[model samples]
Target: METNFAELVDAEFALEPGITYLNTASLGIGPQRAAAALHHGADAWTSGRSTFAEAEAAVDSVRRAYARLTNVPPDRVAVGSTVSAHVGLIAAALPEGAEVLIADDDFASLVTPFATRHDVKLRSVPLERLADAVRPGTDLVAVSAVQSVDGRTADLTALRHAAEAAGARVLLDATQAAGWLPLQADGFDYVVCGAYKWLLCPRGVSLLTVREGSEDGISPHFAGWYNADDIWADLYGPIPEGSLASSARRFDSAPSYLPYLGAARSLALVEELGIDAIRAHDVALAERFHAGLASLGLDAPSRGSAIVAVPGLGRLAAPLADAGIFVATRGGRLRAAFHLYNGTADVDRLLDAVAGRL
Candidate 1:
């Protein structure tokens, strides 16, 4: 597996020489297969060889791929433009003055829609306490499966039990966890993920999976012709309600075609590698990084996550970026993430550089 991981970096990705990217948690490096799809699709469009049906085909392919990866039925997944837009449907459905429980530092896209609603009341807690914080009268619990800030993963099983006991619904944002983590989207009332970060697609692609019957009370306010039961016939309304899709497609945000075209191939790559393989590969690299940090007398959280954070080391972000080592700084921590394309060498390079500075 280690030998294969090293070969994959040169074969799959188009990263430049001297660049060591450890920021899959921020923006992923898409494989060449996916990049080629984008270029080819754009060229076809420019030459008038591409039809709208081709774009629809791309979206359908991606929808199916993501559903398979997350263990959900394809019809249960909703393709969309961004996480915020997908969450809007849920936020709009909340009754007046209902309380929503959320992790305080969760990505803004997951929190903003609900926070902006003056009619909804939000209670924020530390990620570790979020599940236990669920109480009676809490209408919903929203959280990330793997935290974006420092890769602290939520215990969704605990959260699920808490929500069930309280009669609240679960909204899981797997934006940072999806590609490398095993997920069963059926466990959550709704699952939302942005593709650019870990799923390795263009920025415009995102996904929302609705557990069957969970969306009945939610409005499909953003529904457009592309996701309508009949794209051509449903273009303009006084469109009968029957024109809406019989499943979660009714809640889909109109997809951006070219991105979905790229997404289809990138997602195929993920399936080819398989999540369990990717997770093993990624977590090993992270543990290697953690071990290296300990040898250097550096402090970091060791959560067995693909993403790692070095506390109070954010000053290194600028220097690392300058040295062609890409990473992110969040909450006074220097964040680094490992993926299937990374190996021990990348981890060692980061440690050597940090050792020099210290």
Candidate 2:
């Protein structure tokens, strides 16, 4: 359960000395490369050296990076500012009275967008009952790839098969699972993620991937000039009718230049490190942490993913923070997430901090 790649990858992060960060699930530590790319983009924009073409190129890079990571075609990836915005668009595009199934424990971003829609009937079920809850009337199934609170990953293959059998589409929010886990585009009709979390980038940029041919079912309800096939021709010329881009770009939101630049760099770095290696390191660290928790008689909801949620440890968050270990508490559990930058030393620090308090 030792980590061999942590030191090499850890140097890329700007984490301070003597402090442990176990909250990648909440927000990833921004890498120096991403920061540099963001600063460079901002400088260019302020200096009037940045052109529309460069901005478009930056967005294209982000799309391509995410496409490569998810093994999807670049054209299938759409850009958004957050998972809620993109998923909200999908929810709005569904037929009126569409029945959408969601897990009660799923992140709010995955469930709220559809639940708030008056036209859509939302059904909430426990994670264990999701497959059973899917029926002929289910039009869509929405869930996070990894449960935010407990780091429990869904059986996507089983869920996708059931959804397909029931004529329902699957939408996955991959915010907590993308960088540390291997996410394929085939099992899901739509995959959305905010860049601030496991993507290791700044806020204000997200990836929304639409399966080919599935876009036809989703209306571009939030379409803007960015969705147009020819922005200049549609706006400046004769106001050409029906000028929307023919691909998933039709679902893209207006771009944020700096955030896109930073996201592109961060995603590129993730690719360079290789997702398999990152997952291996993360799982190893999580395994060690889980073992330590078990030895301390702590109850962990699940293991194997980057996150480990220990029940009854939520109250120790303040004490852990005082000890210079950062984690997240949700639903009365303390969530410790391991990333490429984490190692056994971090797990040891967390265990030590908790043992001392106990």
Candidate 3:
């Protein structure tokens, strides 16, 4: 009945009382329903009365839910425990002996997969150099919409065009940028992100969206029984030829059904809020967090649309924890992230905690 996009959004999620959680960037605290869903799923798995058919159905629900969220076909959205797992799949699928272009400031998780591959040559190009990085032989141009640490949003339009001109594919690691910007999966051949962050899902569930025609020639190295279209093949015979489903389902590697079910419930909640509303909500919260950090004389390096990074604020990390404020300090900065569920009280609590520590 909630038609208004603004009214449809609810910030009051079931979270622990007396704890100001501001680190949604690292790990999202799920709504009470997501936790409840996980409990029920575990109960089902443990109960001898339940069948594997039921569990598989739950996994399909997740695929459908995430497909709606990312605006891709359910068949194209593969489930993964971590973004790196899916990234490894992409790296393995790249044309043999083709160069993969990565950003100089991309997350290490995104970079490590390409760098470790012997067949793929990794070139860590600066954001400014991205336009020039694409060449005739380039296979993939991979970068995050926003730099994870510094919050630098790159020119996706330009990057997309550049890659297309060179007959290369584009991959976006939207782990940090998904909930903050308009995610256009049109230009990208592949897009992967973990759900625990802005999507407000529990950890261990990641989403990958591949454009309809983009995955035509790619083959998944991480295949399982579920990847086969005739999973219930008692009628058809054992692993029929060409039985593997098309789209992203072909990449499913017996994903943890329990976590996927939990993630599905959480993503359903995100759909109720709608991504555009979430983006506006998160950016506003980040602005408030940036202001709060400034008031406390702490410097937020790379304060962008999603995160507020306070460099050398590790000293404040423990103190803030002692004061009942939860945040993450990584890479030499105290990191505070906000989502739709966080409010001014949360921001003020963090500011006051830092002030008290000082």
Which candidate do you rate higher for TM-score, 1 or 2?
1
lDDT of all predictions = 0.90, 0.86, 0.75
For model 1, how many clashes? 0
lDDT of 2 by residue, 1-358 (tens): 2243555475678778988999999999888888988888889888988888877788888899999999999989989898899988888888889999998888988888887888889999988788888999899999888999899888888898899899999998999999989989756899998878888988999888999878866788777677888776566543333788888888999878888888888888888888898898899999998788789887686577999988877998988888789998999988899998877889999998898888
Model 3 clash tally, residue pairs: 2
TM-scores of the candidates are 0.97, 0.95, 0.89
Question: Which runs of model 1 end up more than 4 angstroms from their true locations?
Answer: 1-9
Give the TM-score comparing model 2 with the true structure, all chains together: 0.95
The candidate with the higher lDDT, 2 or 3, is 2
- The lDDT of model 3 is 0.75
* Best candidate (score: lDDT): 1
Error of 1 at 205 (Å): 0.4
RMSD, each candidate, Å?
Answer: 1.3, 2.0, 2.9
On the 0 to 100 scale, the lDDT of residue 252 in model 3 is 64
Per-residue lDDT over 8-120 for candidate 3, one digit per residue giving the tens place of the 0 to 100 score:
34443656678888877787778767788888878876885556776677677777877776677677787777889888888777766879888886898788888878877
Mark the regions of model 3 whose C-alpha exceeds 4 Å error after superposition.
Answer: 1-12, 234-241, 295-304
Lowest summed lDDT across 10 adjacent residues in model 2 is found at: 1-10
